[model samples]
Target: MKKKVLAAILAAAMAMACLAGCSSSSEEASSDAAETEEAAETEEAAEDAEAAGEETAETAPAADGELIRVGIINNDPNESGYRTANDADMKAMFTEENGYDASFAYSLKNDEQITAAQKFIQDEVDFLLLSAADTSGWDSVLQDAQNAGIGVILFDRTIDASEDLYLASIVSDMEQEGQTAVDWLESQGLEEYNIIHIQGVMGSAAQQGRTGALDAKVAESDNWNLVTQQTAEWNSEKAQQIVQSVIDAGTEFNVIYAENDDMAKGAVAALDKANISHGVGKDVIIMGFDCNKWALQELLDQNWNYDGQCNPFQASYIDEVIKKVVNGEEITEKTIILEEKGFDATTITAEDVEKYGI
Candidate 1:
């Protein structure tokens, strides 16, 4: 009986140990399942965060194909070769095909130009392009633009503003252009001759440049006298009238310093009507600025003594600057000074005409 009781107690202890072992195994299995589920949840959360980050990045600020509002203030649409070409280039680049919104204004006076600039600023244009008719009277307008966060780009002509006022300039050096034509005239070996200076609008940059060299020459020399100096205001009829007046005044001038091709052409018309001998190989030597096709043809035909090249195609460069600024790219130079040369009437060929003629 006692042996039977001992075996029964041992069996009971074995049963309890088996129950404890099963409970511990079940708890371990539950703990392992919980750990796996927690790991999966952690991985899913990480993936969700990564996907959200990608979405934010995709929606972040980008410059690709962005709309840029550009404002252009230039001379009259019917101004001249340089301005005409510039207008065509802008039209080509800023149309629906090129994907830009552009507005343009034309003026021949500083106050009018400033008013146009003010309008652009009021409209909150992204950029402002200027071809100033006069150098002065732009400080206030430009300052207002800066205050409005508009970037200014000078083209064709420059202003007398501080360097920080404008972002860049794409222009021909007017002084250099004048000096080039005058220097070429000097090389023609003409010593003693009266000259008629048919000038542009007074105080304009072109007038300042084209008039400077001849004025200095007059101030220094006694042999070459300026028979008449008058402002044609870049008008052909006015130029003709000025030349006719000089002719009627009985002045014996053998050289004509017309500030532009149109004026020079007008002067030639006057000379022709009056039966005055003129041209490169004639009694009177003629010099003109702006290598327009017609004017350069005149040079090539030896009808003009010299033609100075003043490039007016500013759209390509202005486009480049706008793209760079939009893309956060660095510009190597803020103020780009385009180099130019004079085309001698005697040496210009057809190839020169094709390449350099406007």
Candidate 2:
């Protein structure tokens, strides 16, 4: 009986040890499986993160180093020949090859331009280059740019903002351009000036500056008569309509003072259709701004009386200013006015057209 009990106890002990060994093996297997799953999950997360980093690198404007990001806000390239040349000049200068990562925004309206400026500021561009459509409504946006630590450069046109708002202004002296044209008109010494003043986009810097001198002159001079004053908005067709309406009304006008070459061309088209002789010593004198090659050619051929030079090639000056700012150099000249002149039909030479034409 004692042998029987001892054997039974040994058998039970063996069974218990086997059960404990089985449990230990099962726990080890579970741990190994869990470790493998965790490692796979970690690897997948790393791969996803790496892919995201690559995408960001691809989409970013600047490279690893030395790329100057610029945001150019300008008028529509198709707004006029002058604008087209201006846009082309900016594009040519601010290129990847030229060490700039430039982005462009265009609008003829002031509100739209301000919106673009806000976007560029939000984008954190290194610089903001502007050719404002209108002179007003810029103080707030420019101040915002200043607050954001972005450099502001004015080109082609001026704004009503304070000088402190912009780092540099490389622009045309528009009022001077108007004064030059008016001075030339005064030099003509017409006995009785009956003028059809065809203007550009209303409230624009160009329109205001160009018109201000003429308006003052007309207001002061007793002999000067404004047959009609109208805005063409820089559209040739609108200018034609304005002239045609005057013609139909039989308004006696001896001068067509168009604010731009395209508008002047339109005015001349009306004169041609009416068989009204124009050009040197003709029935009317044609005056225009923006020395487009064709417009200057018109002056050279004695078809247009005068063409004012607006100097659309401001890229070199702007590039230099940008370089100075980047290098932490002081900008001595706050406002750099481009040198410009007016060409008379009687004196404009082919060489002059070749040299000064846009």
Candidate 3:
């Protein structure tokens, strides 16, 4: 009987040990499964993030494969008729149909443009296209873009940053434009150049370059005089006010060298108000830039003396540059200067206005 009791106790002890072993094995299996699931979830999250990035770049990929993400920084289109055509061309080029996922920002202020550029860098854009509002204060932004491995293309006006900062530039020779306009002005054989210099927005490339030639010419001679030199900030109303003030002060000015057509028109209004004859063989010789259709028409009609052509349509060239960037092709030219010309009241025609007017 004692032996039978020992046997029963041993069997009961063995059964308890078996149950404990099964329980521990089950817990270990559950722990292993949970770890595996967590790892898979982490990997999936990473993949989703990578996919989102690809989507931004390839929002509308071309037939080949990769998508080009571009950020365009420019000035307001409403600023001038020239700007209107420029912006429209850019819009037409960087469309979804053209395999580009482009974002655009427009501001007349340099600080605003810089801020927009920062955001584009943060968003990891593939390329940055800029038409700077100011020529200086752009080094920091360009450095940031370089650090991010993004390509930069400059269109319209250029900034004062180093050449290495940008991949390529498609721009007009603004200084040359000013020189051309001034040369034509010099050829007019005026008795004396009593000038009212109506400048564009201060610190702008166009303003600096256009003003440079006339300034040097004036400084070298005694016949040329500055009746009034001021900034109209690219507004026709402000330009009108400036000219009206000069007229009221009895300033003997016989020339209006406005940096743009709109300002020239404003100066013309002032002349008409005072019944001062202008245009061909008139009291004042008006010179303007940007060759807007109406401004060229004024030239054809012999109401304005000169109009300098500032080529605004650079979209096709920009598109070609961007394509090369995406395809890992080499850019041979760092700077691309557009062809431009000057128009005269005697030489301008209606057909010229229809063909070359922007």
Candidate 4:
């Protein structure tokens, strides 16, 4: 009886061990299958992510295989007709169709322009094109751009920053423009010159250059007198008010030197309203800068005595510079000066108005 019980217990123990082994094997197989499936899903996800990245890169803007990225900073487009034309020219040149991924920022304030530059730097732009509203306070931001391997080109106006900070400067000679206008005025040989000087935004290169020549001339000469000098901020209405105030005060002035055509138009409007004669060989000698078409027409008709030419179409020059930069070629000129001239009512022809007018 003892042998029988021992044999039964041994059989039952072996059977239980075999059952446990089978269950362990089944669990191991299930775990292995699950791990393989997880690995496959992870690899598919990685591949999809890589493909998306490539697609994004392919769709991005480039000049040829890769688009050159440019950030342009300019003044308010509506500030004046010249500015409008300038902005339009910039827009036309810096386009994706022309092989550039371009971004633009516009402001009349210096601080705001600096902020925009910082943003463009953070975005890692390849180049920065600037037409600064103010000449001062650009050093630090331009230095930051230089540190980041970004090239800078100055257009329209120059900042007070170091030349090393920029690759090239394509600008009008503002001081020369002013001097030319003043020279023309001097040639008029007015016996007693009393002037109403209307300036653009204060501290701007245009204003400083234009105002400096006239101011110096007036200070040196006994005949040339500034009846009133004020900033019209490139606004016609403000210019009109400035002139109206001078007229209301019975301040006798023979010359109106407006910094821009819009302001000149405003000053003329005030003169017209006051029943004052102006223009060629009139009571007041009207002088203005930035030869807008209408203003040049005014000159051609002898309705304005003088208009100074400030060339606004500088995009082509800028584009060529950028191409040379991209190709790692030497820029022969550090400062590219645009050729400009002034027009007189007496000599300005219809062709001059059509060809030179902005």
Candidate 5:
């Protein structure tokens, strides 16, 4: 009976060890199951968050089937012929039919533009399209735009802002345009380079770039002499008065490098009033920018010496960029430069005028 009791006690101890072992295994299994469930939940949360982000990006403009809001700030449409084309292009692209609700503000003052941009930011526009009146004084506004998650696009001109602040820029290289004009001027084999440089709005991107090249070129050359340098503020009347003032002063300027066609026309008016013949082989050499249909005709008719092309139809390109941004696609090109050509009165043809005249 004692031997039976000892065997029974040993069996009881064995049963207790088995139960402890099973209990430990069950606890480990329960912990493992809990860990697995936690990992699955975390993964599902991440997926849902990612999907929500994608949906927010995809449906950015508004609720289903609503048009996106855009703010367009540009130099006044009355600023120049180029501006007229620019304004028209924007008007055509940012239409209700094109799935946009766009508001516009036009000014030649940078501070005014900054104010408009701030108002647009306050209004919560999805996109801000800029043809800045000036290049500087845009960092703060652009930073605010980044903060608000509004996409900014530059057209016709560029500005001093971080690449992160803007979506893309569609512009003509103003410096290159100036260089092309200067190179053509050099090719003319003129005896003297007495230039009357009538500039556009001071401190503007257009004025700066165009002036930079010519200024550099003049510095390197000994023959080039600027008889009078003045800003016309891109006004025909102001430009006319400028030329008239120069004429009254009796400054012996032979070449008129007017910044725009209107100013060039104004200079021509002054020359016409003075009976100073201008054109091919004339006393005054006339040059202008913005291939306005009428201006190009002047080149074709051999009435104007030269006219440089400044492309203004950047609205379509900006529209495409906005679409890509809205669709969550990557834009590889940060700056898209438009191709332009210069026309000479000597070489310009009717076909050339028709094909390229803006």
Candidate 6:
């Protein structure tokens, strides 16, 4: 009877051990399943949050199809080929498809430009695109626009305002343009050449930039002589008049430094009428800026001399800035300098003109 009791106790012990082992194994499996489900849930939640963020970021501009009014203040469309091309570029970028409503005002005077800026500010435009007529008189206008909560962007011409006043400036370094032209002229090994420098609007950045290098050369070297220098006010007729005056005065000038192609064309027109030979490797060398297609063709046809490129197209880049800024993306640059090149009248081919001419 005692042996029977002992065997029953051992059987009870074995059954309890088996049950314990089974319970331990089941507990481990259940713990692993629970952990896997938790991990999946966490991952799914993270993915959902990421998707939400993307949609939110994309929704702001998508929802506001109302015209984001952008006001453009520029020099007159008849100013130059550069200005004309710039206007066309701006028009193309600010179309309905590009998600902006744009308006423009043109003036060659600072007061007029300031008035335009004030009007745009009153209209509550989202942004102001300014190509200032003069650099110095814009600080007050820019401050007013900033105070009114409108963003200002400088294009083509830069203002002398503090950096914080405007969002960004997309401009060609006018000083550098002049310097490049001077360097090219120096490379041609012309010494003791008399120059007739026809300037643009006297105090404007374009005129100031272009005249500096030549004036510096004259001041420093004294090898090249200034026959005559006059402000054409960037008008072709004024330019023609100035050149006619120079011709009538019997000025002994071998170099014509016109600030822009229009003035250069005007100078050349006077030269042609006076039966003066002008071009590269000719009796006179003409240097001009803003390589308009027609002006470049003149170079290709061996009529005009060197034509430097001043690319005036900036609206596409400005559009990119708008998309980034309005979308809350960080902008890496506050100033963008456009690259410019000088055309060698001796070697600039038709293909070069097509590819690189403004």
- Candidate 4 Cα lDDT to native: 0.86
Q: What's every prediction's RMSD, in angstroms?
A: 24.7, 24.8, 22.7, 24.5, 21.3, 20.2
> What is model 6's C-alpha RMSD?
20.2
* Each candidate structure's count of clashing pairs: 0, 0, 0, 3, 0, 0
- Score every model by TM-score: 0.73, 0.74, 0.74, 0.74, 0.72, 0.73
**Tens digit per residue, CA lDDT, model 1, 241-267:** 999998898888889999998899999
Q: Model 2, poorest ten-residue lDDT window? A: 54-63
> Cα lDDT of model 6 overall?
0.81
**How big is the RMSD of model 2?**
24.8
Q: Stretches of candidate 2 above 4 Å error?
A: 1-65, 109-115, 134-144, 160-162
After superposition of all CA atoms, the RMSD between model 4 and the true structure is 24.5
lDDT per residue (tens digit) for residues 166-242 in model 5: 99999999888888888888888888899989899898667887788789988999999888889998777888888
- lDDT, residue 303, model 5: 75
Q: Output the lDDT of residue 241, model 6.
A: 88
Cα lDDT, model 1, residue 251: 80
Per-residue accuracy of model 6 over 292-353 as CA lDDT, tens digit each? 88889889888877887888878856876776677689878889988788987889888878
Query: Clashes in model 6: which pairs?
Result: none
Reference-based lDDT, each prediction: 0.79, 0.86, 0.85, 0.86, 0.83, 0.81
Better of 1 and 6 by TM-score: 6
List candidate 5 segments past 4 Å from native.
1-66, 109-112, 134-137, 241-253, 351-358
Estimate candidate 3's alpha-carbon lDDT, on a 0 to 1 scale.
Answer: 0.85
Q: Model 1, residue 50: what's the lDDT?
A: 36
Roughly what TM-score does model 4 have, to 2 decimal places? 0.74
